[model samples]
Target: MSKINHFKGVLFDLDGTLLDTIGDITYAINSALIVVGAEPITTSQCKGLVGRGLKNALKGALELKNREVTPSQLEELVPQMLGSYHRHPYRHTHPYEGVEALLDDLAKEGIALGVLSNKADSLVQPIIRGVLPTHSFVFIRGDKEGWPSKPEPDGVYAFSEAVGVPVDQLLLVGDSEVDYYTAEAAQVDVAIATWGFRSRERLLEAGCRNLYSSVEELRKEVFPWL
Candidate 1:
């Protein structure tokens, strides 16, 4: 395990990796589903739906194909969900226990940190701000019109450029298959966060060999120097 000083930079997935956003996400998802006359899904169900971005989450929550969920309906549902989330983004959202301190320790070690999420920056940025009030990422971004979501290598390059680091020296940490694919595509080392939304078995199945069961575990392996 490399110490915090070993890596020039790090990139994190916002929702599942850093913040335990399942509570608010599940609430928002259920609210949106109800508005659309659809059945609500459980928190566990929401866990499977998240990490892929809002559109995909909506699809999974409603159990509908993309085509079946009309664009017009999505237009309505998105705003409803956003409004609900924005109104109470921090109501139940918070960084997983030790992650806030880990972020601080990384920053103190002069390691540049960045955040990446499938939701648009418009949504993810504020949510992160609301949750991680005591820490900050050097570069934070989410899906935008031109920016491709996770599993796309462009986001990795974008974060590297933003943080003034080379891709090879950046460690991408996330909790899903999307993160694994993204790291592979970007040709960077990735550490799977088992404390986040996904299960240890699932992340391993997704080819994530480096798993951290808790925030402290991650801190130990990635930032032992701190």
Candidate 2:
């Protein structure tokens, strides 16, 4: 294996990277679709729609059913979706296999950890707290007002500053092209976790080379010292 660059901090993408949140996300999307009288989407379909943000996912869900939602219409529907999701965020969501252990090990190794996700801040904090309450993240930020979402470098930059780590000394671990682009724009190392939402083929086509098929593989390769 090639030598992995040492990182002082690691910023993880929440939805797919750390947690298997598709069940709740899909539920939210379908709830909004129902409010708009559109047919619900399957989990697989929802997978392709996520990674940008909930608004974009809702818009894509509408498009899948040949329904084009106006901005005003979407504005009305978003609350219903968010409300439904909030009611049952943890009903189906949980940390991915080995994720809790990995986080624990990383913490023990003195690695600063944070979460930077495109999911709404309201949802992100609660979900992380509910699912992985034991781990204390240095920073947990999501899509909030005045903060640009990822694939843009703003979130990553903010995370680096918040964690007191330079961009080059940080690693962004995620599961989508959006995450790959976010790391690229921020000039940080990125490790793509294929066990999440996107397939290895899709991630590779997005120019992601450091692909980890499993959490253990990621630990062994990226933090071999642990």
Candidate 3:
């Protein structure tokens, strides 16, 4: 197969793309749900809820429990979940197989790296530092006041600007339709990591192309020089 290696920078999605954080996220969500008298959801269910953002995840969890809450109520519940998550963020979270080696190789190739997630900025920063301390990223951004979330190009543009890479030269690697749409909106190249929250079939169903089954596949196909 022909190699594709035109990108100078990569923007990764945190939750499913680089790290498998469903366990801790599920724990936090369940903790908040139980406190609110709502039924707790399974880890499998939580996977479908995440990648959008914590608020959305919480909302989805409540829906799964057949409970509905107003926006104000949701706002209040988010902090509870956040507190639970902060207590033990990395309890079961870790980078995917071959992810560290991929990052190391990319860094050596002088490829700018950045992480952008819909997860809270406070949470995203610590997770990366704690989990992948060896790798240096140009920026690690997550949801915060005034910044729009993924599928909205704003974060993607910001990442491009921060890393000093043109949008055309940047590749957004992620594991969900949200990521695919984010790249589409930003007009940047996108490669979906199927080993993430969504399966290859699910991503394809969502109209995602350029799918890679693993970090190794991605490295070989997108960054052959590595």
Candidate 4:
């Protein structure tokens, strides 16, 4: 266990780290694109496009194929896409192995837990309820008006404030460069999940402080301080 995993509370990054919702998101995005008379993208393509908010995700998906849609076109299609996802955020989504157990163990120890994601609020709750019902997270926040998402410190800072813990007392767990940047911007410790979107090399390049290859590893490393 690395010394960095020790912390009082944890703020988790949702999309690629805690839950694998990329398949469902990809389906919705492709459907929206088709409705807009644009081409569709594959699940693999969608994985690379995630982590940022939905707007950026869709923009990246379109850009990957050299397809460009106006901001108005994207805005018009977003609600439909999100509505589709809201209807079935977990049909093809599943928790990474050991995540449920990890959450359970952490909660048992009275460690604070919260979810911070670029995913919209309406969609994040249902997915969590569907996939991790027993995980007693203290708060689950999503992208909102005026609050900058990950890669910016706003969400993490807000999370720490909500948890009644100092920013330095929290551990940010995630799987992307954006996550690392969020932790850095918040001046908190970070634990990168190997099972998510970005590669370990990419995470290191982004200045990740620690890495966990599995949920069990995360539990072992993080629970000691509880």
lDDT for predicted candidate 4 compared with the true structure:
0.81
Full-model lDDT for every candidate: 0.82, 0.89, 0.90, 0.81
Model 1 poorest ten-residue lDDT run: 62-71
Best by lDDT: 3
Q: Who is ahead in lDDT, 1 or 3?
A: 3
Kindly report which residue stretches of model 4 are placed more than 4 angstroms away from their true locations once superposed. 1-6, 224-226
How well is each residue in 137-220 modelled by candidate 1, as lDDT tens digits? Answer: 878888889888889989999988888888878999998889988988998888888888888888777677778898888877
* Cand. 2 Cα-lDDT: 0.89
Clashing pairs in 2: none
User: Across residues 146-191, which tens digit of lDDT does each residue of candidate 2 receive?
Assistant: 9989999998888889989888789999999999889889888889
Model 4 C-alpha lDDT per residue in residues 90-183, reported as the tens digit of each score: 8999988877777777777677899999988878888898888877898899888877777889888788888898876788899988888788
Candidate 1 collision pairs: none
Clash count, one per candidate: 0, 0, 0, 0
Model 3 scores a C-alpha lDDT of 0.90
User: TM-score, each model?
Assistant: 0.91, 0.96, 0.96, 0.91
- Name the regions of candidate 3 deviating beyond 4 angstroms: 1-3
Please, what are the lDDT tens digits per residue for candidate 3 over residues 1-226? Answer: 1226878889999999999999999999998898779978998998888888988999999999988788898888988999999999898999999999999989999999999999999999999999999999998999999999998999989988898899998899999999999999999999899898988888889998999998888887788777
Q: Quickly count the clashes in candidate 1.
A: 0
